[model samples]
Structures are given as structure tokens and as C-alpha cells.
Target: MIHCARTDKGMVRTNNEDAFYLPEGEDKPLLFIVADGMGGHKSGEIASRMAVEEISSHINHSFLVRGSGNETMQIIKEAFYNANIKIYRTSLQREECSGMGTTATMALFKDGRVYIGHVGDSRAYILRDGCIRQLTRDHSLVWQLLEEGRLTLEEVRCHPMKNVITRALGVDENVDVDLVEHEYKKGDIFLLCSDGLTNMLEDKEIRDIILGAESVGAAADKLIEAANSCGGFDNITVEIILVD
Candidate 1:
């Protein structure tokens, strides 16, 4: 496995509210996470940080006890649930963090398959055979509209409410998480990113950049650079995992 990740505050945001986690060393489990937070003051930053930390801890502990098995999806779902409860409780205890929430996108690689747990608008994509396919759907109002056929793809891109996500961690005690499983082979590349990247570049552009890059690290750097070149109105984060 080959992997790399990057995060940037972008051009407009005063501070980055995005956070990500990537396991280090061969002894670590193959897991990756990205979060985009929302709230007042620095609450967004705290929320995102808390999310990645909590989820990673929970998943790690689960693997230690249960071992990776068919229950992997359930373990990931429970991790998200626990992270949501922790973030929500903190929001109620602190004024600045009130209503704080974050988008959580987690990918767990195990036994020739990837299990994805997603909430809010952060995304997961697979690049295989020179094509890119989105693995998770956006939990945003604009996405709902697009699914309902009420809005076109072009309109959704420029919609004023595109940033308004319908679901997020820490916003409520219970959150609906989307879980998916996909098989992977040698040369398959998986990407997990915050909306900051997609909001700036189209899927085709992302596929092209990943294909053109020499390494996973270079692909991450080029993706961030390309998003920043597009004005970078929001914090950008990207994680690339290549199956070797």
C-alpha cells in the first residue's frame, strides 16, 4: 500500500476547519479519515479534530478486540455514532462550540476490500482503469435536489446553498451514516477528501491529475495546488491510497 495526505487553509478562510488522520507504520491498521467542520469561532477546528481522533481511537480499539471480520462495517458505524455523541455533548457544554458539527468520511482497508463510512459532504472516490467513480454521496441539500432532478449538475455547482449540508456529526445525537464496501486490486487508487477539493475541481480533472502524478504524495500536492489555483474559497484536504 502507498498513501499520502495534505491539508491547506486555502485562500479565503482565515483558519482551516478541516482535519484528517492517516495511520503511520506498517504495524498500524489501514485507515484514513477526513473531516470538514462548521460552527462559530474556532469551534469548527475543534469539532473536526475531535471527530478524527475519536473515530480513529474507536476503530483501533475495536480491531484489537474483535479483529477485522464481517463486523468491520458495524464497527465503523459505531465509531461514527460514538464520535457524534462526544461532539454533540461537548457542543452543549461550551457556548463557543454550541451547534458545532463536522462532516466525517472514513475508509478502512481490509482483506482486499475497502469499507467506507460517510456523513455530510466529504467524499470517497475510486480511480480504477483510468476512470474515477464516486463512492459516497453528498449529504447536502443541493445533492438532494440533484437527486430529485430539481437541479442540474451545473446549477448545483454554483448553487448558493451548496454549502448547506443536510447531515453532519455532532449536530444531533443520532446521525445517519452511509456505509459502502468495494473490492480493490493492484493499481487501484482510492481518494478521500473534503468538499474543498471537489468544489473547485471536477471529477475528470481529479482523475487526470492522479493519473499524471508520479507518486501518491505528488498526487496529493498537485490536487491541493490545483484547488488553490481555482480560488480555494474553502479549506482543502486530500488523502490518496494506492493499492500495490
Candidate 2:
């Protein structure tokens, strides 16, 4: 496995609310996480950091104890659920972070399989052969509109409420998480990123950069650079995992 990750505050945001986790070594499979926090006065940063740390710790301790297939999915779900509960409780204790929330996108690579747990609008994508496919759907109002056929891709781009996510961690006592798993093939490139990068570049643009890059590190850097080039209205973070 080859992997690399990058995060930038971009040009607009004074502070980077994005937080990510990429664990090292082989004690367990690679655990890649990306969180895009929402709130003011640095609350967003704290929310994302807490979610990543909580989820990473749970998965590190419990991953090997669980069986594969449905059991693995359950373990992953529980990890995120615990993270949500922790964040929500913390938010309740603080006035500044009262409604703090964040998007969580996690990817686990293990034994020829790929599992994804997603919430809010952060995304996971797989590039196999030359085609790019989004693995997780956005839990945003605009995404719901798109699903209902009430909005087009072009319309979503211009929609004022495109950033209004319908679901997020820490906002409520519980969150509905989307979990998925599939057999991974050699040469498959998996990407997990915050909406900052997605909002700045289209899927085709991301595909082109990944295909043109020489290494996973280069691909991640190029993606961040591209987003910054396009005004970089928000914090940007991306993780690239290549199955070798």
C-alpha cells in the first residue's frame, strides 16, 4: 500500500478547521480519516480534532477483535458512533462550541477489502482503471435536491445552500453514518477529502490530476495546490491511498 495526505488552511480561512488522521506501521491496516469542522472561534478545529482522535483510538483497539464482512462494518460504525457521542457531549458542556459539528469520512484498507464510513459532506472516491467513482454520497441539502432531481450539477454549483449539510457529527446526540465495503483491486486509487477540495475542483479535474501525478504524495500535493489556485475559499485536506 502507498499513501499520502495533505491539509491546508487555504487563502480565505484564518484558521484551518480541517483535521485528518493517517496512522503509521502495520500493527493494523491503514486508517485514513478526514474531518471538516463547522463552527466559529476555533470550535470547528476542535470538533474535527476530537472526532479523528476518538475514531482512531477506537478502531486501533477494536479492529483486530472483530470478524470480517458485516462484523467489520459494525465495528467501524461503532467507532464513528462513539466519536459522535463524545463530540456531542463535549459540545453540550461548552457555550462557545454549543452547536459545533464536523463532517467525518473514514477509509480502512485491510486484507484485500476497502471499507468506508461517511457522514456530512466529506467524500470518498475510487479510481479504478481510468474511471473515477464516488463511493460516498453527500449528506447535504443540495445533495438531497440532486437526488430528488430538483437540482442539476450546474445548479448545485450555483446554489446558495450548497454548503448547508443536512447531517454532521456533534450537531445532535446521534448521527446517521453511511458505511460501505468492497473488494479492492491492485492499482486502485482511493481518495478521501473534505468538501473544500471538491467544491474547488470538479470530479473530472480531480481524476486528471491523480492520473497525471507520478506518486501518491505528488497527487495529494497537486490536489491541494489546484484547490488553492481556484481561490481556496475554505480549508482543504486530502488523503490518497494506492493499492499496489
Clashes of each: 0, 0
Model 1 residue 111 lDDT score: 82
User: lDDT tens string, model 1, 1-244?
Assistant: 8999999999999999999999965777799999999999889999999999999999887864345555888889999999999999999999999989999999998888888999999999999999999999999999999999999999999999999999999999899999999999999999999999999999999999999999999999999999999999999999999999
Q: CA lDDT, every prediction?
A: 0.94, 0.92
Clashing pairs in 2: none
Stretches off by above 4 angstroms in model 1 are 64-69
Name the regions of candidate 2 deviating beyond 4 angstroms: none
Q: Could you give candidate 2's per-residue lDDT for residues 155-201 as a string of tens digits? A: 99779999999999999998898999978989999999999999999
Highest lDDT scorer: 1
Q: What is the C-alpha RMSD of each candidate to the true structure, in Å?
A: 1.2, 1.0
TM-score of 2: 0.98
